[model samples]
Target: MKYHVQVFVSLKPSILDPQGRTVERALSHLGHENVSGVRVGKLVEMVMEGERAAVEAQARALAETVLSNPVMESFRVEVRELAGA
Candidate 1:
């Protein structure tokens, strides 16, 4: 079976994000004052072929060990079986 996976990686709240702060400052400067406390993160999408349980396990392992930094970042993984594949 083939699965579609989405991995969302973000900095832990305890960590300061300079890039997010910079973007928020830029937006405020551009007259978007309502935009505050902005956070920037990454979305990774991929397709993998495996059994349902194995695919989920692989996605979690990849997210924990490769896609995110354990010291400062966290991640969530979503998996869906592809249709007609």
Candidate 2:
């Protein structure tokens, strides 16, 4: 089986995101006053070949241990099986 995985990694709410704040200010300066509280995060996409349960477990483990920082950041993992290809 083949799995398509997506990991979203972002800073925790308790952590101050200077990049996010800077982007928010830039948006405001560009005349987008309605935009506020901007957050920036990264998405990692990959395809892996494995059993369903095993692939999911591996994705979760990778997200927790490698893709995100436990101290200041958090991550979410999503997995889907590719069909027909």
Candidate 3:
């Protein structure tokens, strides 16, 4: 099976995000005053071949230890089977 995996990483709520604050200010200056509490995060996407369960497990483990800093950051993993592949 071929799976599409996505890992979303972001700073924990208690952590202050300077980059997010900067982006929020930039957006406000650009006339997007409705935006608030902007937070920057990372998405890591990958395509892998394996059993669906195994693939999801691997992706979750990768997100847990490799893609995110478990201390100050949190991550979520999404896995879907590829279509027409």
TM-score for candidate 1: 0.95
Top model number, lDDT? 1
Candidate 2 wrongly placed segments (more than 4 Å): none
lDDT of 1 by residue, 1-85 (tens): 9999999999999999999999999999999989888999999999999999999999999999999998999999999999988
Task: Report every candidate's CA lDDT.
Answer: 0.96, 0.91, 0.93
TM-score of each: 0.95, 0.94, 0.95
Clashing residue pairs in candidate 1 (N, C-alpha, C atoms within 3 angstroms): none
Better of 2 and 3 by TM-score: 3
Task: Quote the positional error of residue 28 for candidate 3 in Å.
Answer: 1.2
Candidate 2: which pairs clash?
none
Worst 10 residues of 3 by lDDT: 76-85
For 1-85, candidate 2 gives per-residue lDDT tens digits of: 8888999999999899999999999999999999987889889999989898999999999999888888998999899988864
Clash statistics: count for each candidate: 0, 0, 0
Clashes of 1: 0
